[model samples]
Target: MSLLAQLKILVVDDTTTSRLLLRDALETIGFRNISVAANGEEAMKMMTTSPCHFIISDMNMPKMDGLQLLKAVRTHKVFARTPFMILTGNADRNVLEEGRKLGLNNYLNKPFTPEDLKKALEAVVGRLQ
Candidate 1:
């Protein structure tokens, strides 16, 4: 199999629509090993049980937000080096700042097209071919 097909990816978002959109976009870009979580708390659980190479999460969610999840991931030695990108509609600088402090790899605002998603992913983890 191609490397992209085995590159495990996690998509965390509160809204089902956003999660589906991201999953679809990732699939369109040739990623097959993708998983989804509704909130950061759930995402964390998924992360520990089934580790991912890349994480694409939203900034805001119930129980735990993206930054919290990022903090958790970064603080933990196992997932500390994993590539993390926040795909959020939130424009709050404070939130983004927190994410940066927590070692966010990259971020992309919502309402994004598949091309935009590809570029964002490329920016985070190099070209995905």
Candidate 2:
């Protein structure tokens, strides 16, 4: 089995389209164990129930934003070392810097391609292959 296939990834985004797009990209890269959450709150709940190896979360969400999720994960000993990748349409340096401070593995802007997602995932978890 591929190394990537062993990883259980959690994708958190408010939009159904974004979630589906991300899932397709991940599947294309040979990731089989993938899960989705619409917001940080759901993500957290899922984490408590079944922690994931990696997380891809949108920076902006209605219930709980990515930064807040990052903070919450960081505080939890079980999830502190899990790889986190932030997805955002906003290019605000301040927001990015804040995520950096909170220990995000990487960040990908909106409208990213499959290659962009692959690169971000590789940067966090090492070579996908």
Highest lDDT among the candidates is held by which one? Answer: 2
| Candidate 2 weakest ten by summed lDDT | 120-129
* Cα TM-score per model: 0.94, 0.97
Candidate 1 C-alpha lDDT tens digits along 12-128: 999998989999998899999999999998988898898999999998788988888999999888889899999777668988788888888899998899899989888887877
lDDT of 1: 0.89
What's the C-alpha lDDT at position 112 in model 2? Answer: 90
User: Once superposed on the true structure, which residue ranges of model 1 sit more than 4 Å away at CA?
Assistant: none
CA lDDT of every candidate: 0.89, 0.93
RMSD of 2: 0.8
101 Cα displacement, candidate 1 (Å):
1.3
What lDDT does candidate 2 reach at residue 13?
95
Each prediction's total of clashing residue pairs, residues at least 3 apart in sequence or on different chains, is 0, 0
